[model samples]
Target: MSSSLASLALVQQKTGAAQLDRFGDPTIVGVALAYFAVIVGVSVWAARRTRTASDFFVAGHGIGLVALTVASVSTSVSGFAFIGGPGLLYSVGLGALFLILPAAVTNVLGAWVLAKRMRLLGEVRGLMTVPDAIGARYRSPMAQGLSGIAILVGIVGYMATNCLAMGYVLDAIFGVGVTWGIWIGMGVTLAYSVAGGILAGIYNDVFQGTLMAVASSAVFVYVLKLGGGMAGLSNAITPTDAGFLGPFGKMTPLAALSLFFVFGMGSLGQPQAVHKYYMLRDPKQLKWYPMLKTVGQLVVLLLYFGVGVGVKALVSAQRMAPLAKPDAATPSFLLQFTPALLAGIVFAGVAAATMGATNSFINIGAAVVTHDLPTALGRPLRNELRWGRISTLVLALLAGLIAQYSGALVAFLGVFGWGLFASTTVPALAIGLNWAGATRAGAIASIVTGLATTLTLETLAYLKLYAFPAGVSGTAVGLVLSLLVFFAGSWLTRARAAAAIDGDVRLVMDV
Candidate 1:
C-alpha cells in the first residue's frame, strides 16, 4: 500500500509538470479571447469613419501625433521585434541586438531626412502612397510604376513574416496547428483591414503598442529575477557558451556591423513607417517624433533582448531544457516560466504586433494595386475605395500562402523584406525628395537595379544556389549597388536631371 501511494504521487507530479510545459492554459485562452474581442470592436468603430479613399489609405490625414508615433513603432517593430528578434538573439547571442539597437539613430535620421518632406509633399500633391510621392518628386509615371511593383513584392514577404509569427502565437494559445493558426490569424487581420483600412490599423496599433510596452517591461523584470540579473546571466551562459556575452556575441565583427548598418540606413525606406508621415495631423509635431518613437521602441525591445538572453541563462544553469528551435524561444519561455496571465498578455501582444503590421502592409499593397498602378498607367480607378478593400482580400490570401510555404525563419524573412524596401526606395524616394539634382532617369535606374539584384540574390540564397562572403549580406550589396547607380546615373545625366525637377517639387524639397 505504501509503495502504491508513492507511485501515484510521483505520477501526479510528473503530469503537473507536463501540463505546465504544454500551451493553451485556460487563463491564457481567456485573455486571448478578450484581446481579440477588443480588436474586433476597434475595427468596427474605425469602419464607420472610413468613407473615402483618402480615409482608407491615409486616415484622412487627421491622425494625431501621438497616434502616428505609436502606430509607426507598432508597424515597424511588428512580430520581428517581439518574436523573431528573440529567436535571432537566442541563435546568435548578442549579435541580434544589432538588428534593434539602431532604432535610436534610425528614428532620428528618418525624421530629419524624410518626415517633413514626405508630409509637405503629401499636402502639396494630395499623394497617398510612397510610389505617389516618388512619381510626384520625379514627375515620371514609369518611376512610380516600377517602385509600386517593387513595393508589392516586398509587401508579400514582409506580410508573410508577420503572419507566420501570428500563426505561432495562435498555435500556442489555442492548440491549433500552425496551418490553421495562420489562416485564422490572417482572417482576423483581414476583417479589420478590409473594413476599416488604415484608420482601423492606426488605432489598433495604439492599443497593441500600449499592451506590448506594458507586457515587455513586466517580462523583462521577471526575466532579470529568474536569471539573477545581468551579471548572473552572463556567468551562467559564459561557461557553456564562451564569449556569448561579447559585444558581437557569436557573430563576427563585420557581420554584426553589417546588421547595424543595413538596418540603420534601411529603416529610412521602410514603407510601414515612412508612409505614416502622410497621416500626421501637424508637420510641426515632427519635432517630437524621433524622441517618442525611440523611447517606445526601446521599452518594447526589452522583451527582444530579455527573452533570448534569459532563456539562454536558464538552459545553461540547468534550470530548463535547451530549446528545440530558436524561433520557439519566446513562446516556450512564456508557457513554462512566466505566470499564466502574463503569458497570455504577451501572447496577445505578439498577435497585436503581427496584426498591426499586416494591416498596414495590406493597406499599402492594396493602394499600389488599386491606386498607384492604375494612375501610373493613365487609368486611375473610378471607385478606389471599393477596389482597395477587394485588393486587400486578394493580397492577404496570397501573403497567407507565402507565410505557409516560405519555410524560412521569421527573422530571415523580415530581413529580406527590409532589404528589398531599402534597396528599392531609399535612393529614389528618400534622397530624390531631398536633392533637386536627382533625375527621373536616376530614380528609374535605381529602382530597377534594386528590384532585380535583391530578388535574384535572395532567391538564389533561399534555394541554396549561391552564398555571400562569411560576413556579407545580399541586402547590403544590393543597397550599395542601388546607391551607386542612383548617383552615377544622375551624374551621367546631370543636365536632364536638373531639368526634370518640377517647380512645386523643388519648393517642397526646400521646405
Candidate 2:
C-alpha cells in the first residue's frame, strides 16, 4: 500500500508536468516576445539622449505628466498586484482590500504634500536620489551613508521579489526551472535598463502599464464570470472564505492590524513610489497625480480581489491543495481556464508587471550607488551616466542572484522590502517633511532603532519564538519604535543640536 501511494505521487507529478508542457502555447510566447522587443526598441531609441548623469537618473527632469503617471502606476503595481494580490485573495478572502487603502493614501499624500517638495528640492539642490535629499538636509556623511546602504539593501530584496514572481510564473507555465525564469526575466530587464537607464525604465513602464491595465480588467471580468458572477460567487464560497468581500472580513484582530500597518504606514518609505515625485515635469502636475494614482490603485484592488475570490469559488480546496504555492495560483488559473490568446496576453502583462517593478528598483538603486553615495562620501565621480548604467546592471545581477535562492511569496517579499524601507526611513521622511524640531541625531537614532527592532522582530518571527499576530505586524512595531526614538531622541538632544536641526526643518517646512 505504501509503495502504491508513492507510485501514485510520482505519477501525479509526471502528469502535472506533462499537462503543463502540452498546454504551453507558442502564440502566447510570441506575444510576450513581441512586447519585450518593443520595450527594448524604445530603450535603444532613448539611449542616445541619456548622455548625462542627471538625464540617466531622472530623465533630465523632463518627463511629462502622462509618462510620469504611467511609470508611477507601473512601479507601484509590480509583481505584487499580478501574482501576490491574487494569491492573497485566493488564500485569505477579502482581507486583501486593506492593501489598497494605504497605497491610495500614500499617493494622495505624496502628491499633495511630498511631491511638490521633492520636485522643488530636486531642482534647487540638483538632487538625484533619496539619500541625496537626506544627506543634504542633515549635512552628515553618517546619515547619508546609512540611508544609502539601507536603500540598497531594501531595493535589492524588492527587485529579487519581482524576479521571484517571474520565476514562479515561468515555472508554472513552461515547466521550466525557477533558475531559468530568473535568468530570462533578469536578462530582459537588464537589456533595456542597462542600455537606456531611467529613460528605458520610464518608457517601458508606460507601455507595460497600459497592457497591465487592459489585461487586468479583462481578467477581472472573466474571473467574475467563471465564478458565476459576483453575487453568486460570493454566495457559493463559504463564510470563512469571504474575506475578500469586506475590509475587515474574517481577519483576526492582529491580522487586520498587520494589514493596516504594513500596507498603510509602510507606503511612506517606498523609494520607487517616492521617487516618482522627483521625475514629474513640474510641481503643478501634482494636481493630476492623485487621480491617476487612485485609478491605478482601484484597478489593482479589483483585479486581485476579484480573481482571488473567483478562483477560490471555481476550484475546490482539494483541487487547489496541490497548487498551495500562492505565486503559482495566477498562472495555474490562466492555464486551467482561460483561452490561449487571453491567457497569453495576461501572461505578458504579468511579465511586464515584474519587469516594471524590477526596472524601477534598478533605477532607484543605481541612483543611490552611482549618484547619491558618491555625493555623500565627498568623492567626485565623473561620467555619472556611465556609472549609473553600470550600477543598474550590477544591482540587477545581485537581485537575480538573491531571487535564485529566496523561497518567499511575492507578497511576503514585497512586504518585507517595504518593511525594511519603512523601518529605516519612515521616521526620518515623515518628520523631515512635517516636524520643525526633527534633528539629524534624532533621524539617525530613529533609523537605527527602527532597523534594529524590525530586524529583531523579523528574526524572532522567522524562528517561531513568538508568533506575531498577523495584523499587529513586525513593521508596526518597528514604525512605532522609530517614531518614538525620533521624537524622544530629539527632545533629549535638542538643547545642543537645536540650532543646526531647527534651521533645516524650519527652512523645509516654511516653504
Could you tell me the lDDT of residue 100 within candidate 1?
A: 88
Query: Which stretches in model 1 have alpha-carbon errors above 4 Å?
Result: 1-22
Error of 2 at 438 (Å): 0.6
Instruction: Estimate, for each residue in 176-246, the C-alpha lDDT of model 2 and write its tens digit.
Output: 77799888889888888888877888988888888888888888889877777777777767643544456
The TM-scores of all predictions, comma-separated, are 0.96, 0.92
Writing each residue's lDDT as its tens digit, candidate 1 over 83-115 gives 899988988899889888889999999999999
Would you list the clashing residue pairs of candidate 1?
none
For model 2, state the Cα shift of residue 459 in Å.
Answer: 2.9
RMSD of each: 3.8, 3.4
